[model samples]
Target: MKELDEANKKYNSDFVEKVKKTDVGENLKRIKIKKNVYIDSLIQPGFIYYIETGVVLRSFVDAAGNIKAIDILCAQEVMGLRSLIGRVGVQLEIKALEEVTILIIPEKLILANLQDAYHFLCSNFQYTMSIMYLHWQAMLSFGSERINYALIALAYYVGTEKDGEFFFPPYITHDVIASFASVTRSYVSRHVSKLADDDILVNQAKKMKIKDMDTLIKNTPNYQSF
Candidate 1:
């Protein structure tokens, strides 16, 4: 993991530089989506996703009848990478946790650009696997009773800030979060209050500023051992 992080820094930098260039000579063009919304809820349900800015979550319900968030996508992360390739439409509804600008490219256009479409398909398969792994880590992080679901959501939504504060917008209501964490709204509300009372969170008009991100991450109990 340590070596991967070091290698990732170089790849990420190069990726950013490549993305900045205006001339890529592909059939792809940019489309801006300014609204803060669930991506699956907004689009016509058949567009490819390449995020230019902001974040989104690709999630669905489990067979055990639990709604779970499977992915937290950020800038440079591809959207509908898994659901729209071989599939007709998205089986999992993607929710936008933040105001976003997604570059929607047509699936046909992307396919046309691929000389080796099978290779492209394989790479997308790996990307989907990566998202699944991240979600598995998040699930393990949340299954602990020692940690509140709100903290789980925050950690999943915004892991840690540069200033070591995990600032989160209060747009996430308890009711909406209920389905994701597989907890009742009342349970989520109770934890929200506890964090606020502990001064771990400051409830702003539209957001909750979480202080002490390091302590939150550290003190957050692990469930894997149990």
Candidate 2:
């Protein structure tokens, strides 16, 4: 376990070093965010963030007065690119799921300094498209199957493989899952229990594990090809 932890640390360090070598990364300002703190208002126009460590929960209050989790981002991911590109006012509320370190870079600087914007643009586009697809899938799953769709979407966002087993981060709770599913907490709990009973998922001490990846992908609607 200690070896695994060390390997993960080294991997993250190597990734950060690679990012730091980029033109936009060279001039970035690092900011540390405490857990549960709101960061949306801190993001001004023409600025974007790059996650260096920890998790960030992107959520927003809907028209029905309910806060919804739009996405969960971790290290090596970019945030606020959509808002910057659209030149729109900030609408998303970003919260730190844990102690987070991010590098803030001005959009103007990136555009001016980066020789090849294609890679950055492609990365942002792909992430945005995935989130958009998740929203679309959730909308399609509205009535009775929403929970399943939400679980698949959440897995796509934060699930990682360790020793060939897929698991979600320990920080992800029923409430967070509820927000992602846009369902009630009770509903999430019930569905999660059902998944456990069905042997699709296992709620363990520190994480929720997907028992069979092939079975899960096959059973989840609109996720078979994903």
Candidate 3:
């Protein structure tokens, strides 16, 4: 996870530098978003955003009123690309998990620059493939292992590391994990408690910390492939 974070940071830095060298980059607008705020204003057509800092939850509510978490984006992520490609019809609910800073770029600007457009598409493709891979892995698993894998996946994307331990933010409650795992909140709680008891992880104050990565991987079937 640490290596992945560093890689993303480097990529984002390089991408920003490349964009800044172009004329379109001069017109980029930066904005700050408060935690728990919905970005309705940025949902307008012909714009995309680069996440300069913090995390955001991308989700959708079904007709049954079930909220499904589609993505948990952090620093270096690009948002609104799916809409530009005409791949999404149902409106996605995007809310900040923490204070966020983003650089807004016009859609036309990106389209006019072949290199920028290609990089944007490549980043989106990598992200989509990762999500698809996790979905496929989850479908092949069952019971508590699925929940564990969900935690692992979440940690990979948004968990912060300090002194060799990984911690998920307080905003990521059991309900959020349940939504990500496509499981009931109670089921998620039970698995989480078990992991806590085993000293593999601990959940308190609405935050989760992973203590034993090896044990966690062992409990999660086929997690090494992830």
Candidate 4:
């Protein structure tokens, strides 16, 4: 699993390095953003962004005016490709999870510069497929009778490891977890407490950490399939 994880990281790094060699990176405008900063979609309709560092949470406001987290993106991920290429409007609100650096590239320039847009499009398509798979997994988890396992699955999906502990990159709150898992905050709190008591999860400085990855993964729905 560690080897596979390293290979995946290498693949993403190589892909991003390839893109950086292209003309797109030569003209990209680097922007540094602080945590919790909301990126307005209207600010750059014809531009797409590559996340150079940090994490981003893509969310939408529900009818009740509650923010629902849709996806969490990390380094080497591309954002706004659908809106830029399909001419669709960006409906999701992008919020910085931590201090982030993004490289903005105009869509028109990419099309004009790339000798073969196919490669670029294929790379983006692969990322889209991964995101779709995650969404599908989440949907299936939500369909289950138990919400705790679903939340745990989500935590595993988006978490990053440091010093042998897997931590949620954005330091997710119970409210955010509740919103994503379609449960009440109290329900999430109860499960969280139970997990902590059981030593499966640990809370340190407001960040949730997985104490045992193997145990957590074993408890997740359709773990064998994963």
Candidate 5:
């Protein structure tokens, strides 16, 4: 999370301001998406989306037609890099987990307007690598430990923080967490109850919070090894 946070801080926040003064920017489509809405069934070519607020889940369908959650991305993240090369479909799907605002810019426009394109691309690469690293960590874990790591990641990526505690919205149900952890919903519920009993977490009515991060991390085997 530290590395990911640092990369986020390096993103050029001024990109929008610079774009606003240009003619192409005037035609930029910034759309508001409601919670639980699907952004697209298949990847769209020739455009990239800049998340302005809220979170989304990125998933892909396998040959078996089963959808699996691959990543959860939040504000300031840019998606659809493959679209720049005209890559379309591939069974990718994007769905809004929260009310989201996204700025859809043509690929050429992002390249033309983005100052420090190298750093921007690097930052995006860092974010992608971070998620892959987390997936690798989860692969080495098992049972509740896997769930623990998933919760920690979800907290960092999608939860809101206040006074050193992380609060996850009500829509982040056991099923949602189970998908990320590659576990069953019942398994997630059982482990979450154990965490609550230990006072490391608080989950009520589908909403959750990390009440004690140190204790929660202690339960996640090898979580700090990275």
Candidate 6:
């Protein structure tokens, strides 16, 4: 199991396979967190946190003090990476959407534990940035690729599985996805409804199922393929 864990760490880069996934109660030092544990609440004098479950929103306030969300991370994203690297506590708030079991370790301890995972994290930072840049440009592109790529990412990250098909997670309020896709919920909804009308996807139990991958590739919206 130890050897298998290392191989998984090498291939997956998150070391999720290496960590012991004990149930929430089994932890000796359990910290209970309620919803919206203010994104910056996790940062204090000395600790770093790893996600146990639930979503974490990375957000900031404008000069007028209105919150603007910058990123949403579900399971596995390290909270307070900047502080762990070298700095004061993170300026970003990391709120939880539900009860979560965050594994906490002192910043220095985590740095000590990183002897093996450093290579993985350093290389994977490029991957993370590239992904962010792709989504950033997706809506700006004049072609159909933006929407398509966004859907692919959504499916891989948050989609559900049923009856041999993968579907978008349920209760993904139009408002939420709109933020990442860089479109208004109304526009996202109209496009989504159109796909369902054409059977490219289906709204089943309030979830969007990607029923036809080939059709999506063959007939993209506003596409001009030879």
For lDDT, the strongest prediction is 3
- For candidate 5, the TM-score is 0.86
| RMSD (CA, angstroms), candidate 6 | 6.4
lDDT of each: 0.55, 0.71, 0.77, 0.66, 0.76, 0.56
User: Which 10-residue window of candidate 1 scores lowest in summed lDDT?
Assistant: 1-10
CA RMSD, predictions in order: 5.4, 5.5, 2.6, 3.8, 2.6, 6.4
Candidate 6 lDDT, 103-154, residue by residue in tens: 6655444344465457545644654565456555555544334455456555
lDDT by residue (tens digit), candidate 3, 43-114: 656677888998888888888888878878878877877676776687888999899999887776676666
Per-residue lDDT, model 4, residue 117, is 48
Tens-digit per-residue lDDT, 1-226, candidate 5: 7556656644735555555556453667888999999987433677767888988888876677555678877777777776665656565678888899988766666677666556666677777777788888888999888899889888876678899899997767887788788778899999999999988899876678999987888888767533
Local distance difference test, candidate 5: 0.76
User: Which digits, one per residue and each the tens of the lDDT, describe model 1 over residues 135-180?
Assistant: 4555665532423544554454455454766665454555555655
Mind giving the per-residue lDDT tens digits that candidate 2 earns over 84-111?
7777543888899989998887765666
Model 4 lDDT per residue over 1-226, tens place: 2333334445545545555577543776889999889875533667767778988778777777876676667776667767676665437888887888888877656666455445656655665566556556665664222345445645556667777677775457787677676667787788777778889888766878888766766766553323
Task: List the candidate 5 regions with Cα displacement exceeding 4 Å.
Answer: 9-12, 63-66, 86-90
Instruction: Indicate the worst ten consecutive residues by lDDT in candidate 5.
Output: 12-21
- The candidate with the higher lDDT, 1 or 6, is 6
Stronger candidate by TM-score (3 vs 6): 3
In model 6, pairs of residues that clash are 39-93, 39-94, 40-93
lDDT of 2 at 20: 57
